[model samples]
Target: MIEFRNVYAGYGGGDVLQGLDLKVEDGSITCIVGPNGAGKSTVLRVLSGLIHPRVGEVRLGGAAIHDKSPAAVLAAGIAQVPQHNALFGNLTVHDNMLLGGYILRRNRRAVRRRVDELAEIFPTVAERAHEKALNLSGGQRRIVEFARALMTGPSVLVLDEPTLGLDPKTCQAVFETTKKINSLGTTILMVEQNVRFGLKLASHGVVMERGRALLAEPADDLLRRPDMGAMFFGHGIEDPTAAPQIATASTDSSGA
Candidate 1:
């Protein structure tokens, strides 16, 4: 399990996560959704050790990791696929996958074995093994990115907007791949822009506003709420029939 207890963090300017608290259960797919600048990506950054929380603690399986370095976090079994393209354009897809296991380069045999295993799982990796990353289509590249992230055999996979900007068919492909990955026993923690699709794909859902988690519950229940649109748009819920499980927050919005 992953837990963030009163986490407060941000870039150099100001706090993006304001006294935030969240929890991700083990072996579950937890999807977080919110409007722009709700600090969605920032949560993934804190988890990946790209930024350390100024206050509070982040724990993975009960081990505190808020202060750990990026490498340490990766070694501790958490891997992230960022929102933007991260592949080296000039490098071959195979080379990129090799780089994902750079820390284990000393054991060339094991790393190579892992790559071969992933290539079997992601056929695009095998079909375009020698092709430069720049040569693959957007969808193919994203698949390679997913395969590369698995090189470390992480217990948890963090994805930020995995299907952003893709065609509808590609979006479905990506979501299918996400499900396949989850079936392989890795816990998934993701931030997605497509609310309905994301909620449908997840076992649990979290709603965020102004850097705070406003609601956390089973994804189906959240999806069924009639005031979902109101929540995302910052309009107070007028539905007296709405679930009482939702926690209300101040109307003011800030941070990214």
Candidate 2:
């Protein structure tokens, strides 16, 4: 399980996460939903070690990870796919995937084996192995990103708006792939803008406001609550449309 206890994190300006506490069960898909600037992405940043919390404890199966560096975090079994494009446009899809296992470069055979395994899992990787990443469509790129992140064989996958900007069909495809990943035994922690769809896809759901989680419960229970829509958007959930306002923090920066 993953746990965040009283996490207080932010950029140089001010705190974005105010004593935030959240828990994700092992092998479960947890979707986080909230209004813009609610620190949803910031939560991911802290988890990925892009920024360390000023006060808190982040643990993975009871091991402390709050103060680890990004590399250490990755080594500790957490891999993240950012909201923005992270592909090397000029590189072949195969080459981009190889980079995902850069830390294991010394073990050439292992990295190649992992790549081959991922290609079999994500069809886009198999079909466009030699093609440049820049040439693939948005949905295809997202699939490749998922495959790449899995190259490290992480136990936990953190996704930030995996379907951001894609059409409805593409979003469905991404969600399906997410389900497939979770079924394969990787615990998933995701932040999605489509509230209804996200809730439906996840086993657990969290509602955040003012940088703190206001509600955390089973997804179905949250969906069944009559006041969910009003509390989250001041309206019904019929037309859920709100994007996160903050920039995602990159591995090299704290300016999320």
Candidate 3:
């Protein structure tokens, strides 16, 4: 399980995540939803080791990893796929997958074997093996990103808005692939913009406001809550323009 206890973190300007607490069970798809500046993605960054918390503890399976480097986190079996493309546009799809396992450079044979295994699971990887990532559609590129993240055979996969810019059909495809990945035994922690869709796919749900987790429960229960839409998106049937109730001072309303 991944747990955060009273975590506090932010960019140089100020704190974004303030006294946040969360838990992600092993072998489950936990989806986090919130308004624009609720520190949703910031939570993922902390888990992935891109940033460290100023105060609090981040533990995976009861072990502290709060101060580990990004590479260290990856080696510890957490792979993160950012909101934007992290792929090398000019590189072949196959090369990108190989790069995901760069830490395993000494074992060329194992890397190749893992690539082949993932290609079988994600047919798009094999189909676009020789193509440049830039040439694929948004949906295809996202699939390749997932395929690449799995190259390291991580125990946990962190995804930030996996279906952000895809067409309806492609969006469904991506979610389906995510489920397939989970079936293969990797825990998934994701932040999503489409609240309803994300909750439907998740086994657990987390609702955040201004860096603090206000709700945590089974996804079905959270989806059934009458105030869910209002709580996360700052809009309900009656108050369409109501501002999201923030719990902190910083208002960097970009990602997370």
Best by TM-score: 1
Backbone clash pairs in model 2 (N, Cα, C under 3 Å; residues 3+ apart or in different chains), count: 0
Cα lDDT tens digits for candidate 2, 29-117: 99998888888999999999999999988999999999999999999999999986889999999999989988645387888889999
lDDT per residue as tens, model 1, 107-186: 78888899999989999999999999999898998999999999999999999998888888888888899999999999
The C-alpha TM-scores of every prediction are: 0.93, 0.89, 0.90
Per model, state how many residue pairs clash: 0, 0, 0
Alpha carbon lDDT of residue 3, candidate 3?
84
Q: After superposition, how far is residue 183 of candidate 3 from its true place, in Å?
A: 0.1
Worst 10 residues of 3 by lDDT: 247-256
lDDT of 3 at 183: 99
Query: Lowest-scoring 10 consecutive residues by lDDT in candidate 1?
Result: 247-256
RMSD versus native structure for model 2: 7.2
Which residue pairs come into collision in candidate 3? none
TM-score for predicted model 1 compared with the true structure: 0.93
